[model samples]
Target: MRTQVAIIGAGPSGLLLSQLLHKAGVDCVVFERRSPEYVLSRIRAGVLEQGTVDMLEQAGVSERMRKEGLPHDGFTMAVGDTRLRIDLNGLTSGKNVMVYGQTEVTKDLMDAHEARSAQVIYEAENVTPHDFETDHPRVTYEKDGVSHEITCDFICGCDGYHGVSRTSVPKAAITEFEKVYPFGWLGILSYVKPVDHELIYANHPNGFALASMRSETLSRYYIQVPAGTDVNKWSDDALWDELKIRLGAQAAANMETGPTIEKSIAPLRSFVSEPLRFGRMFLAGDAAHIVPPTGAKGLNLAASDIHYLSNGLIEFYGEKSSAGVDHYSQKALSRIWKAERFSWWMTSILHQFPDLGAFNARIQQSEMDYLASSHAAQVSLAENYVGLPF
Candidate 1:
């Protein structure tokens, strides 16, 4: 098979890129190592930055999001016993975030793909990109024990961290930066009303906890746990009990407990690979970078990557200009570093670090206090949270 672009991975990044390119009349095909069901079954963060929402709209796949996604103008942060609210809408001049699950976003993109009759080959095994550095790049994979290949002008590596896309690049061609946190987030999803109308991020003596919701009835909550903690060790009641204690009295009083439906522990890490573009192959989303979920930047960063990549490809195909394509790496990396800093800062301030001294605790408290009191600090947080312009 031959196409203009071959996208590896049918996740949101690849789907969004393919949809955008399809709308722009650029032909592309997607290859996925797993079935659609398996892909959608993976639970992920729900917070949506403004730029992500806009990009979904640009891809013509956000109608359900606009209809069902909850909008939050602000969130409350509990520092010790005090709960302080960060008014995102107020601080950012009416800009806010949308609470929509990543699963729903993928579904919408998939639906749009089906409507357009776009190509997505699921269960493509051993997928590999070839000759991306040359004028002609191609992808090869095995399906149903049969080998197949696609000849394309360019390749999009949208596969996640463990996927073949990033690994395909020679180590010498990419410089990597990574920091694995000493903690992980033990998260649970349940069918219960959320503790607060808006999300609440709590910094407690024991640990950090976040009370978030996917909708009015679907709650997603998380608490910081020691690294390598097992999810199976915590019973449903124990999880709720710990959450109540960490979230404080008022929130706990309003919180409802229910049978846990999904539970897992996710390690926190900040990672980036410099030079997003390698010859004719471009890495987007988790393939290029990762961030701690503290600031909810992972998925938003993916959206920005697609924005940069799609525009660059569109420019190249339309005007036959290489300007956007040439500078894609630098442009994407500039915004990525800012997000990385924000996520790292938020994680540092909100979570309890192992072996942290009393002096460090006092400084963290002072930082939170200043963030609560200073308009400049609030504005900066709001702007980054709502997302910088794409």
Candidate 2:
């Protein structure tokens, strides 16, 4: 099979890129390893930056989100036993986050793609891109125990950090920068209702915890845990006790822990690969960079990367010129680094470090204190959190 673009990985980045390109009359094929059911059922980032919501609406994927997603006006910052509310409306003039999972966004795009009769090759195995420099790059995969190849002019690697696309480029010329945190977050989705209407970020002597909701009936929450912690180690009752100690002491969280739906220990790290493109293949989303979850910027960054790549592709393929194409890497890097810095700042301000100088921990606490006290500090966070406009 031949098309204008051969996209690897059917995650949100690849799917959205295909959707945007197809809407512009570009031909593209998306390949995925997971079944449709697993892709839709996975629980991931649930907060949408205001800008992301706008772009999805313009892309015609926000119909269900608008009807079902919960929007929050602000969040509570829990430090010790004091809870300070940062009204997002007061900070950003109505900019806020919509509670909709990244998985949901992927499903929405997938459904729309199918309705348009778009080709999404699922259960595709051993997918590899070869000869990217030419107009006939190929994606080889196996299906029904038989191997096959799809040829295209360009290849897009949206398979994320663990994928081979970034490695496909020469390492000597590539520069990588990453920040790995000592701790990880144990996230759980519960059938119980959220303790509060808006999300809560609780800081304690032990660690940090967060209270967020997926819907009115279902809620999501997280607590800091040791690195490489296993999700199965904690029982439902045990998780509830820690959550209460962190979140309940402040702001009267009437949390009721129901059946545990999903639990995972997610590591905290920040990674960025420079020059997100090489030859005829480009990388986006987790394939390029990763951020700590404290700021909830992962999906938003992925959305932005694909957003820019789509525009650049339109410019390159439409006019038969490499103007935008030539500068795609540089253009994408600017935004990528800005996001990296923001994610780093938020992560550092929240999590505690062991054996640190007492001054350092106090400094972080002071910063949080200032954010609660100073409108300027709160607005700065509000801008980044609502997400850089798409």
Candidate 3:
């Protein structure tokens, strides 16, 4: 098989990349290792940055999102029985965020590209990359226990961190920066009603917790858990008790409960590999970097990668200009670093550090206080949270 571009994953990054390339009239094929149902049902990531929303709008995929996505004008931070609301809308001129899951994005993008049949192949497996240095890069994989090969002008390594794409780039060719947080997020999704309109990030002496929701009948919540925690030990009652304690009993009150749908633990980490491009193969999304979920930056950053790569590919192949393509790596890295910084900031501010002395505690309190009281501080958080222009 031959294509103008070969996308390695059907995650948000690869799917969106294919759609953008198609809009540019670039012939492309997408190979997804998982079935479409799995991609649409995988529950993760619920915040859409302002920049990501803009990209979706420009790509003409925002009709469903604009209609269904929950808009948040700000986020509330609670610590020591006091709540501080960061007025994002008042801070950043008319900027806002959307509380929608990544799974919905996969569904929406797939629906938009429904007419572009033969562009996506699901249940594909054993994806391998080869001859990326040549004009035709080869991506070989097996489908239904049969071997196959796909040839493209360029290969997008969007499979993710654990997939073949990142490892395909030699360790010597890639400069990596990574830090694993001392804690992880114990996430739960229930049929409970949400207690608040927008998200609340609560910081307590016990730990940090995030309160969010998926829809009117679904409440998605998270509590900071022990590093390397075991999910098996947590029962539905135990999980709800922990959440009630951390998020406050009042907020947890009268929250409906059903069969605990999804309960999983996610490690907090910041990972980045420099020079997201190599030869004819380019890396985008989770294949290039990962951020701790504190600031809700992971999926948004992946969207930004597609935004950059699609624009660059169009300029290179459409207008016959190599400028955007040549500068793609450096251009994407700038926004990546900004998000990394913001994610780290949110993580550190909310979590109580073990080594933090009384002075440090005071400082943290003062910082949070100023963020609530000062316009400049609110603007800084607003701009970072709503997102910086990509």
Candidate 4:
């Protein structure tokens, strides 16, 4: 098979990239290691920055999201028992975020791909990109006990952190930076109404807790646990009891609890790979970087990467300009680092550190106190939460 672009992975990043490229009349193919059912079954962050929402609109997949996704102007944070609300829309001049699940976004993109009859090779095994440095780059994979090869002008490594694309790069050619947090988030999705209309991030003596939602009636919440915590150890009732303690009295009082539809634990990590481009292949989304979910920048960062990437591809194919394609890595990394900083800062301020003694704990408290008292501090928080300009 031959195409204009060979896209690795069928996650939101790859799917969205393919949709945008195809809309621009650029032919591309997506390869996935998992079945469609398995791909869609994975749960992920739902908060969408304004930029990501705009990209979805541009991709012509916003109808369902605009109809079903919840838009929020603000979110709450607790410092001890005091809840501080950050006016995201107000501080950012009406810019806000949408609470739409990533799964839904993937589904929409998948539907768009099918409507256009774009190619997505699912259940592809041993997918690899070869000759990326040369003029003619190609991807190889196996399907149904048969070998296949796809030659393309460019290759997009959207496969994610553990994916083959990033790993395909020689270690000496790339510099990697990473920080693994000592704790993990134990999250649950349930069919109960959220404790509050907007999401809440809580800082308590026990740990950090978050009250979020997928919709008006479908709630998603998380609490900090040990690094290797097991989901099976916490029953639905037990999880609720712990959440009530960390979220404070008022929220816990009005919060409804029910059997969890899904539960899992995700370890926190902040990672970034420099120079997103390697010859003819470019890395986007989790393939190039990762951020802790505290600030919900994962999907938004990916969207920004796609924005830069799709523009580069479009310029190459439409305008016959190599400028965007040439500078894609530098431009995308500039934005990626900012999001990474924000996510790291939020995580540090809100999460409990085992070795953080009296002085450090008081410092963290002071930061939260100032954030609530100072308009400037709140505005800064709101601006970053809504997303930095892309």
Candidate 5:
């Protein structure tokens, strides 16, 4: 098979890219290693930067999102009993965020693909990209008992961190920077009204806790736990008790508890692989970088990557120019680094570090205190939260 672009991974990044490129009349195909069910089953963050919401609109998949997604102008940040609302709309000049689950975004994109009969091969094994250094790049994979190959003008790796796309490149060609946090987030999804209309991020003596929701009736909550903590150890009631302590008296009073629909513990990390481009192949989304969920930048960062990449590819095809693709890596990394910094900063201020001693704890509290009192600090937080411009 031959195509203009061969995309690896059918996640939101790849699917959204394909949709944008297709709308621009650029032909592309997507390949996924897992079944569609498995892909959609993975639970992820729901907060959407204003830019991400706009991109979904551009892709024509925001219908459901517009109808169901929650829009928020502000959220509260708490240090023990003290709470300060960061007025996202006022600080960012009417800019705000949408609370929409990543899974729903994927489903919308997938539905669009299916309706258009876009080529997305799922459950393909041993997928590999070869000859990306040359103008002609090829991807190969096996399905059932047969092997197949696709030759394309370019290859895009949206396959994620453990994907084959980045691993295909020589180690010396890519520089990796990573920091693994000492703690993880123990999160649960339950069918109950949220404690607050807007999200609340709390830093307490016990740890950091976030009260969020997927919808009006679907609550999603998290608390910081030591790294390598087992999910099986915490019963639903036990987790709820800890949440009450960390979220403080006000939130605890309003909080509602229910049977958890899903539960998991995810470790925090900040990772970036420099030079997202390798010859004819490019990396985007988790394949290029990862940020701790503290800043809610994970999915938003991916959307920004798709913005740069899709536009670059569209320019290359529409104008017969290579300039956009040529500078794609540099441009994408510039934005990527800023988000990495914001995510890192959010994680640092909000999470507790046991080994850092009491001095660090006091410093964290002081930072929060400063944020509450200073308008400039609130503006900065609002800007980053609503997302830096794409």
Candidate 6:
């Protein structure tokens, strides 16, 4: 097979890039190691930065999102019993976020691909990119006991953290920065109305808790737990009891409990692999970096990666220019680092760090107090929260 671009991973990042490039008249093919069902089954964060929502629109896949997704002008931040709403719209001059699940976004992109009969190969085994350092890059994979190869002008790795794309590069060529948090988030999805209309991020004396939702009736909630905690240990009722304690008296009073549809514990980490480009192959999304979900930046960061990458590829094909692709790494990393910083800061302030002693805990409280009282602090938070300009 021959194509202009061979994309690895049919996740939102790769799918969005292919959608944009296709719309721009650039041919590309996507390869996924797992079936579409498996991909959609993985539950993820739902909060969308304004920029992410716009990019979905740009890709012509935001119809369902705009119709069903919840839009919020602000969200509340709680320190113990005190709550302060960060007015995202007022602080950012009407900018706000959309509460849309990552799963739905992927489904929309996948539907678009299917409707267009785009080349998206699922359940391809051993997908690998080779000769990315040369002018001609190709990808190889096996399906149903048959091996196949696709030669393309470039290769894009949106395959994620454990994907072959990043591992394909020599270790010495990539510099990795990572910090594993001391705790993990025990999250549950329930079919009950949310405690609040908008999301609430709470920092309690015990731990951190987040009350978020996918829709008016679908509640998603999380509470911080020690690292390596087992999901099987906590029953639905037990988890809800913990949430009540951490979210405070008022929120707990309003909170509705129900049978959880899904439950999992995910560890928090901040990781970035520098220089996203390696010759003709480039890394996007989780393949390039990861942020703790504290600031709801994981999926948004991926969308931003697709933005820079698709633009660069479009420029390369349309104008016969390599400038965009040449500087893809630098441009993407600049924005990636900022998001990493914001996610790190949000995680630091909201999560209970085991090693950070009581003095640091007081300092965290002071910082939250300052953020609540100071307009400048709120503005800064709102700006970063709504997302910086793409």
Candidate 1 whole-model C-alpha lDDT, 0 to 1: 0.93
Against the true structure, what is every candidate's RMSD?
A: 0.7, 1.6, 1.7, 0.8, 0.7, 0.7
Off by over 4 Å in 3: 253-258, 357-359
**Tens digit of lDDT per residue, candidate 2, span 1-390?**
788898998899899989889888889999887788877886788888887787788678999999999998787776654567878877899888899888879889989998999999998888888987666688898877999998888899999898878888888757899888889999998888788889888778778899988889888889999887878889988888888887765434587767787888899999999888777899999999998988788998888888788888888788887777678788778888888889888777666666546898788777777777788888888888887664
At residue 233, candidate 4 shows an lDDT of 93
- Candidate 2 or 6, higher TM-score? 6
Residues 1-390 of candidate 3: C-alpha lDDT, one tens digit per residue: 788888899988998888888878898888888898888877789999988888888777888888888999988888765688888898898889998888888888999878557478898888988988678789999988999997888899898889788888778888999998888988999887887888989887878888898776688888888798999898998877777777777677855556688999998899999998888999999999999999899999998888889999999888999788778899999999999999998898888776778888887787788777778877888899998887
In TM-score terms, candidate 5 sits at 0.99
Backbone clashes in each candidate structure, one number apiece? 0, 0, 0, 0, 0, 0
TM-score of 4: 0.99
- Residue-level lDDT tens digits of model 4 in 277-329: 99999999999999999999999999999999999999999999999999999
Error of 3 at 217 (Å): 1.9
Query: In order, what lDDT does every prediction score?
Result: 0.93, 0.84, 0.86, 0.94, 0.95, 0.94
Over 1-390, each residue of candidate 1 has an lDDT whose tens digit, in order, gives: 899999999999999999999999999999999999999999998999998998898888989999999999999887764568999999998999999999999999999988878899999999999999999999999999999989999999999999898899999999999999999999999999999999999989899999999999999999999999989999999999999999999988999999999999999999999888899999999999999999899989999999999999999999999899898999999999999999999999889999878998888899888987899998998899999997
Please identify model 6 stretches exceeding 4 Å from their true place. none
Clashing pairs in 4: none
Put down candidate 5 lDDT per residue, 15-76, tens digits, no spaces: 99999999999999999999999999999999999999999999999999999999999999
Per-residue lDDT of 336 in model 5: 93
Deviation in angstroms for 59 in model 1? 1.0
Clash count for candidate 4 is 0
Please report, as a residue range, the 10-residue window in candidate 4 with the lowest summed lDDT.
78-87
For each candidate in turn, the TM-score is: 0.99, 0.95, 0.95, 0.99, 0.99, 0.99
The better-scoring model by lDDT among 2 and 6 is: 6
Off by over 4 Å in 4: none
For residue 122, what is the lDDT in candidate 2? 90
